[model samples]
Target: MWALDSGICNSLEQPIKRCTAKVIAFDLETDKTVKTVDLSDILKPHSRPQYLVTDYSPNGFPYVYISDAEGAIIVLDIHHNKMYRVVLPRAISAGCGESDVLYLLLVRRPKNQNMVIFSYLCGNKVYGIKSEFLRTGRGSSAIVELGSKTKHSVLLGTDGSNGVILRYRSESELYKWNTDQPYKECNFELVQLAEECRLSTHVAPGGKDALMYSLSSNVADYLNHTCGAGGASARLKYISKECEDDCY
Candidate 1:
């Protein structure tokens, strides 16, 4: 498994400057750390970095993409032990202030795994770029304005295809849309967990198959009635139409 080390910055007044973040990998069978990649040197001064591991390359190279909250992404080639920084175009980063959060999601094309849809949510808008362009460290002009959602919308995950999953903060239904489809037409309801309250939902990682697993819990009862008072236990549900299969 892979995990990030945000470093020792929590107690410091100026936390960003003291962060010594790194990424670590572990062996599952033996439960031992196999590798540790220090990222302090490449990260922007005083900036904490967030990272996501991409699926193995078509050529089988392992890659890790890191963002330092700057308008750029740092691509680390784990196989070659090299790093490249790719800056986002103004079309994607323009007007986004320093306080705004940048959310990145990697969605592979169903037809071609070699092609990756790199999507980032900044403010209320989501933008897309081809991963190939990012790998080349080029400022791509092919950036696509995927769509915009209400400021209250939360990005759930991808559909193991081109569809981006999302949900309104006040709603309990999950909605999705293919990147190629019109944003206004992205009202396809993927699932509805509850009618009265919004459930906390999370899509599991590793989009290897058509079937996706989601974990959900009714947290409103826990909040309103107190911990363990009326809250529902977390449940695992399959995203396929055969919802009754292997649910727990």
Candidate 2:
């Protein structure tokens, strides 16, 4: 089953006050429609329904979290046949995929300030953590640089149960696996190893899949030996140098 995004249907021809878009779910197996949710009253007219992200509830319910470009997250309770909205402090940029934990990654900045901040949404509330280690530069540039450096990052599997797992290319020219139990309030750490890798929390479950990098040089040697490239294979290309425009 998949969700369909019906873009702005002309309200001028229709007998309605506002333009309404519908999200419909189809049962591919039975070839029948399951449910239809109208988004006109809940979301603004200009909010494009093109890119929608879905997250299954970890609480073992049929509550599917649906988010769109306009920062609106609608929780559709399939069992209860009701829909509710999650109050977001700001537009969420990241969230868990396939995992049972309903964690959302949020990046916040103060108005007219030269600072970039990171926070997480768990248990229906936004919580800010100590991320001084992530502040590489001042102002928006810092966030931009961090985002650029970690652009090739991945969401590795969680820490066993109820934990967040992330893997990304670091600014230190090393591939690292960042793991933490954000829901449990545990200390997060970045490990210089890659045993498992996953996807970004901000992207859809089947969206852009991230490439997993192995930290061990032996893996590179093995690939080189098998392929007979001898030097600088695609595996080694995973390691990258810091950008020259780096503020720090």
Candidate 3:
């Protein structure tokens, strides 16, 4: 199922009627339920000039790609609001783009050095991508960085390519897996890893052939509840497995 982050919770009422902040949540395909959570209530945002970064966890949770004034990735306990900045070796230029698959790319190229490790919080798990794997000035503009998916096995994808890699974009790089192929340029705007790695397209379960109950709504209509990825963190509320097909 595909989802976006604009919803009623992020809406304002009058002349000052609009939230500048983006609200996040999830949309389940089985039942057209737009599950949204108010982030403002979840995290305290400072009212100062703060550089921002954002990415979605594997299951579509907004795994906030947070950073600080000094270009350092901030690791935090989302539920408790505690934060610790994991500084990269040097300032790295980065951007967030996803492929046909579900892996998020955190491509960082440090200006001062040829290596930079990526660090950030996603699915409530702290992760790191070292610079050795991402040799900055390498022959190929592409580099294979590794990490795991919501499913445990390690996943690797090419970051940055032979394109106009914005030299100034140093916040975070998001990617998706479409297939096992190393990379395939996406016709879609998002940076896709390949067709093999893309997450399965979801459709509402209906009719007699339907083993599950799918909530109906435009994929764009509802906010999806982010199920923290790979079961790495605390369990979010699980409603049931009573559908035609078990979902456990």
The model with the greatest TM-score is 1
> What is the per-residue lDDT of model 1 for residues 1-248, given as tens digits with 9 covering 90 to 100?
87877785543245443546788889999999998888866777645465454656667777777655566677777888888666666556556666444555677774434333343344556666666666656535646676665545556667666776666665666667666675554455566444334364566544565665666666666546654644556666765443552554
Ranking by TM-score: 1, 2, 3
Instruction: Score candidate 2 by lDDT.
Output: 0.36
| Residue range with the least summed lDDT across 10 consecutive positions in model 3 | 162-171
Model 3 lDDT tens row, 159-238: 23211111001121223333222222341123322221113112122336423221212222122334334322211111
lDDT of 3 at 174: 26
lDDT of each: 0.61, 0.36, 0.28
Higher-scoring candidate on TM-score, 2 or 3: 2
Per-residue CA lDDT of model 2 for 1-248, tens digit only, reads 65645553453355344335667778888999987777666666444343333333334444344444344344456666665544334423354222213233322223312111122222222232212212211222222212212133333333222233444332222222222212222243443333222112221112243332222233334433553445432222222232222211
Candidate 1 clashing pairs, residues 3+ apart or interchain: none
Residue 122 of model 3, lDDT score: 25
Q: Candidate 2: worst 10 consecutive residues by lDDT?
A: 130-139
Worst 10 residues of 1 by lDDT: 112-121
How many backbone clashes can be found in candidate 2? 2
